[model samples]
Target: MKAKVYVTLKPSVLDPQGKAIKHSVELLGFSGISDIRQGKYFEIAIEGPLNVDQAREEAVRMAHDVLSNPIIEDFRVEIEE
Candidate 1:
């Protein structure tokens, strides 16, 4: 089984890296770019059974424990059988 986790800042949070990228895009002549956000993608391979609920729990726990700072970020999990 595999899990793909995407960790991103909440909409209320500010992403300086994303802002910088947006600025660069504008400088390069890309018009009407309103916003951008930076995030992390983690692909994990597991040896356990494909229990979606269990995997989601584990993934959320992992996100809280190590993958992200709960104070500033949020995470979503995608599990593959």
Candidate 2:
């Protein structure tokens, strides 16, 4: 089984890296861009025989406790078998 975790900053947090990338894109002639946000992606491979729901629960716990900062970030988890 595999778990995909996407960790991103909360809407209220400022994303300097994303802003810089947006600026660079504008400088490169891209237009009509309003905002950008940066995030982290994690792929975890589970070794045991776990069901989709169990894998999701484990992934969600890991995402909340280890992958993301609860105060400034939010995370979504996907399970693949």
Candidate 3:
């Protein structure tokens, strides 16, 4: 089983890296770009005999406990078979 976790900054947070990318894009002639945010992606592979549901539950816990900061970041988890 595999878990894909997407971690991104909260909407209220500022993203300097994303801003730099946006500026670079504008300098390259890209127009009408409003905002950009940077994020993190994690793919965690689980071994053992746990079933899909069990693995999903564990993955959710992992996402909450280890993968994201509740104050500044948001995260989503997807289980891949």
Candidate 4:
């Protein structure tokens, strides 16, 4: 099974990196840009003996425990068999 994870900062949090990118975009002459946000993308491939539901459960657990901090970050999981 394969899992694709997307991790991103919460809307209430400030992202300096995203701000910098937005500034750069403006400097590069991109107009009408109201806001910018940044996020992380992860693709994980798991092997052996697990059903799709089991894999999704395990991936969500990992996202909460290892991949993301539930306080400042949020994550979404996409499962493929």
Candidate 3: where are CA atoms >4 Å away?
A: none
User: Candidate 3 versus the native: TM-score?
Assistant: 0.87
Question: What's the lDDT of the predicted structure labeled candidate 3?
Answer: 0.90
Q: Output the number of the TM-score-best candidate.
A: 2
Off by over 4 Å in 4: none
Tens digits of per-residue lDDT, candidate 4, 1-81, equal 899999999999999999999999999999999989999988999999999999999999999999998899999999998
Q: Is candidate 1 or candidate 3 better by TM-score?
A: 3
Report the number of clashing residue pairs per model: 0, 0, 0, 0
Q: Which rank order by lDDT, best down to worst?
A: 2, 4, 3, 1
Summarize candidate 3's per-residue lDDT along 1-81 as a digit string, tens digits. Answer: 798999999999999999999999999999999987899999999999988889889888888888998889899888898
Better of 3 and 4 by TM-score: 4
TM-score of every model versus the real structure: 0.87, 0.95, 0.87, 0.91
For candidate 1, the clash count comes to 0
By summed lDDT, which 10 consecutive residues of candidate 1 come out lowest? 44-53
CA deviation > 4 Å runs, candidate 2: none
> Weakest 10 consecutive residues, lDDT, candidate 2?
46-55
Residue pairs whose backbone atoms clash in candidate 2:
none
Question: Model 2 lDDT vs. the true structure?
Answer: 0.95
lDDT of each: 0.89, 0.95, 0.90, 0.94
TM-score of 4: 0.91
Model 2 superposed RMSD (Cα): 0.8
- Backbone clash pairs for candidate 1 read none
Q: For residue 35, what is the lDDT in candidate 2?
A: 89
Model 3 / residue 35 / CA error / Å: 1.6
